[model samples]
Target: MTGGPATDEATEPYRRRIAEIWSAALGTPVTDAGHHFFAGGGDSFQAALATATVRREWGLEITVQLLIDHPVLGDFSERVARCVDER
Candidate 1:
């Protein structure tokens, strides 16, 4: 996954996009990347929806385990971008 302060600038937009996804799926505003999806009332079913949405929107495959592991938006978005890059 992309790392360091340099990526922060690039990841800012990704953070916004991910926050939007979280807000839409969880039905709550998620302004911070540190926010936890599960803590915000997101379950595995919602995570599946999120995975599907990401797949459809970005054309990149994301596993549910990834979401489970990276519940934080910043970490999850970094993983998503890594998967996209690898593919």
Candidate 2:
């Protein structure tokens, strides 16, 4: 997260917000956008909770499987942003 610039301006906010949500859900500071969720102590239950939080916060329907599909925080953030834009 620190070493590289965010993928773009559109995704940076999503990335930061997701990192905060995932950090709380995972009980660890998820500062690195490239870090894998599962590798950062995330599980299915936590993923569900995190996505639920995202839904509540953004009013977006992000499936938990999206996180499973894109485990990397950066990729996940990009997808989430796309989802938001799509809606």
Tens-digit lDDT track for model 2 on 1-87?
333454477789999999999999999999887889998889999999999998898899778989999999988988888888899
Task: Provide the lowest-lDDT 10-residue window in model 1.
Answer: 1-10
Model 2 regions lying over 4 Å from their true place: 1-7
TM-score leader: 2
Clashing residue pairs, backbone N/CA/C < 3 A, model 1 = none
Model 1's alpha-carbon lDDT is 0.83
- True-structure Cα RMSD, model 1: 1.6
Best by lDDT: 2
Worst ten in a row by lDDT for model 2: 1-10
RMSD of each: 1.6, 3.7
- Candidate 1, residues 1-87, lDDT tens digits: the string is 447887777677767888888889998899987888898899998898887887887788677888899999988877777677688
